[model samples]
Target: MLEEFVSLGKWWLPNNPEVVVPGKLSFSPVSGAKLELIGSFYSSQFEEIGQVEGIELPSDFVSIEENFNLTSRVRIDFIKPEEIIILGLLDNNEEITLYRCSGRMKSFEFVKNRPNLLFNIACIFRKIHFQDEQNIKLKSISVQYSHLEQWIGKSGIQAVILEEENKIWISYQPPSNIHLTKIGSLDLNITFSPINVNPFDFYLGATYYKANIEQKTYLTIQNPGNQPLDECINLLISFRDLLSFAMTKPTSVISVTGKTDVIQTKPIEQANGSITLKEELRETQVIIMFGLWNSEKNSETKLSPNEMLFLFSDVENSLGEVFETWIKKRETYESVFDLLMTTMYTPSLYLHYGLINIIQALEAYHTSKYEGIYQDKKVYEKGLYKKFLEVLKDFPSESVDNENGISDEFRNALKGKLKSQTRFTLETRLKEILSEIFCLLPPNFIGSLEARGLFARKASETRNALTHHDKEKRKKAGKGQELVQLFHTLTVILQICLLRELNIPDDSIKILVERNRVYQKEWRPSSN
Candidate 1:
């Protein structure tokens, strides 16, 4: 569901500032937030005294509707007490633009009906812009994660309860940040902004915390000659996805903002008196958002640090080690990465596909990270396969390749089959990934050795079942709670496989697996 941000203000095309249209800008979840304009064209046509242009309002709307590029609708700028930049204002609805004439005007102006405007969506930038461009320049990017404090488990205060004495004690102290990690050439720091709390506020029921602090982790590119906005956003979004994977749920980004520029100066003191100066960078800040990831949530789910795949101690922790490999192989792994991340937001009925997505993600992961060919084609082609093809080329149409005896076309048909025949099957690749990952973690992290074998067979068959809708394989495929267990198993496997790919130590990931609450809960596949 979309939250609402409404502004009652005047809107005008940047080029036609004199013809400001009085209207309100509204955004909601329904119909994806369209901004409607009332009395737009007729009001503009009747500017000042009654002087109608050669063209009629209705004709202009019709002409613009036919030729959208010919109109002055590149961007409709709105201003409340604060300014709003509305980019890409396309007419959203197919319904006729309503129109009604004024009661009386005594001139040609009265004849033109006022038409209403509806614009689909536009990126709303509340700050100033020097000029409009598809991509923006950024000095640095700041990102805040939902429940970051809960994930980091760091704060400025603690509460202690003595149940026997029926006494409660609260203590406040200074908060500190965790160690910073470097992703690619960028430095990632999780900084906190603490707000001083008063004990008196709790008695008034206006506040809940003894102390409040917010996590605003920011990234700065190392030795960047010209900081690229896209690069920063990539790392931000990539890490956000990793966090989503960690939380076992999709975590909304509280805010993502770019600071385009900053300036620093020292205050000056004159002989007559001392002077203090304060200033802000012009058009320096702009907030960025993806419409689907609305920050406001009706319900919140918080987890202990140990419950997540990402384990952090308030004393010692680093996320960069795992993320380093992710960034380098991000493009290669993008397909699988996106597939796995989507399952977090999937509906329950479609969760059967969640199992399917993990299987696809695993297959994709292996394809990208491992050689899909089970054996080299040249090895077989130069010897047995070559001999077989030579025999087929001259066979007198009485040969056998299988149940269907060979024809002259058999040679060419065999050539086509050879391409895929040399490649590994989904079952083989599944086992290979399983075998390599097993040595990296505790023995049977998913289950006992036999159970692990059963998981691999069922997963591979299920992949075949879902792909071709094979009835027999589908009968053996995971379903009901079995599907749920398999989904959880594949998730843990992918998470650990990625950790190993990143060169994270075996011992480190094993410790995370043992500590993880969900992994421990769902590790025993036989329980299902």
Candidate 2:
């Protein structure tokens, strides 16, 4: 298996061969320019399947380089039994190659020196459909990183291909929190244009970031019963190890700060950085200073933790000590909850804002239908807030006693106690209000809102566990489970809500429902 696999590196081979051996195959840079030649020769067929690697001219699709570097041999056992599609970034243009190598039929050689070269050895493998002559078509290949070329063989890509496809479409402007993950299930057809294609595959491969992990998903063309036109397809959806790049190496520690209030810190280039103990880092805090705000007089205002809290507050405030006092007073969890409640009832708040807008628009349509006589602008809002208060009044903050068999009064008292100290912080209030408004939403709105509620609850739980929960509880919670659930739930809710709000009036909402159903059908307790 290993011998056949090694045959892939060699693009050229000696005349007809005999015995074949299995061994490891690897790629190393050759010269100073952005050129690399992949080399390999098979022992059995005595042929070279040489690959000329270098920048292809901007105008030309295929270019043969003058010189080649890097030499290796083919491993017979490792010869891919299926069709393979690989991508090479030549200059700025991307070149995709489909290789259909069967058995130990070929090989090639690479030159040893040169500096400017970059190659990602990962390839997408799909079953081959060979034509009579030389034309070949690959269907639904498993796409993966180059490192998986070892132990996993052709099957390593399966982890991504067979995994579930989760997508959501949001219709808000960017720079807005029109989140893709918070609404949880992503199978919905979202209205987003493509960014640069991840170099994972030349075609049928795309990716999006979720929880900071780069996941590559492929889209392919297939007939879905009578839908016309080519549809996007999936090959694999897997996470790549950040350390795969030879140019990237880890170091001890590095720190940087921001200059302006508007500057958000995102990685442009990652370099030598190491993980450290929380205590060590705590001693020397890395205060990333994104300018908070500025006064009219051009005086720069640095935001303290309390000032930052006020900045995110729902109510606008002045910049003086009065505003600071108000924020400090309002920073309690109860204050947040109250803001959440207000936001949930109002149409302009985070989660509730979208629902309110939709419901208000729908109510407007309903009123215009009956020409204002039947219009009850307050019905939706009324029902929503009533339910909000009801839930707030009834929701038990503490667990019900199973062994003690407590009385109803005891339970009620316990619930009230939980509520007493629990002031509505802005974040909590927003989540709760949205959850309630969504719940009380007309039948059309409930499904998506419920999903969003589930997502928010999960996120809240996870955040709590990370920030405040004891070690024992964290252990019981397991790793990343809550966060994943939160993301999934957010995806579903966002898609449902966005689809409904777009008011496309065709089958858009129906399409989202159908997609959700398709995903729901596959849900299992074990997977959760």
lDDT of all predictions:
0.58, 0.27
TM value for model 2: 0.21
Q: Judge candidate 1 at residue 460 and give its lDDT.
A: 81
Q: Write the residue-wise lDDT of candidate 2 on 1-528 in tens digits.
A: 000111122121112223222222332111101112332232121223455455343543321232222232221222322223222222223222323222322333325421111222322111211121122222211222222222111111112233365644333221211111111111211011123435665475555465222222211222223221112111011011110111011110011111111112343433556443332211111111011111011112221222111111212122122222323333332332233223222323344233333333323322222233222436633664456557655655444545645556765675555433323332343355445335323244324544544434444444445555577556533244433433333333433332232232224334434433322321112334
TM-score of each: 0.67, 0.21
Overall local distance difference test of candidate 2: 0.27
Q: Per-residue lDDT of 102-172 in model 1, one digit per residue for the tens?
A: 21222232345455555444344434432333234565566776656666666666679999999887765
Worst 10 residues of 2 by lDDT: 243-252
Model 1 CA deviation exceeding 4 Å by range: 1-3, 28-34, 39-122, 127-140, 159-174, 178-187, 196-229, 257-299, 314-317, 347-349, 381-415, 443-452, 517-528
Badly placed stretches (over 4 Å) of model 2 are 1-459, 466-489, 497-507, 514-528
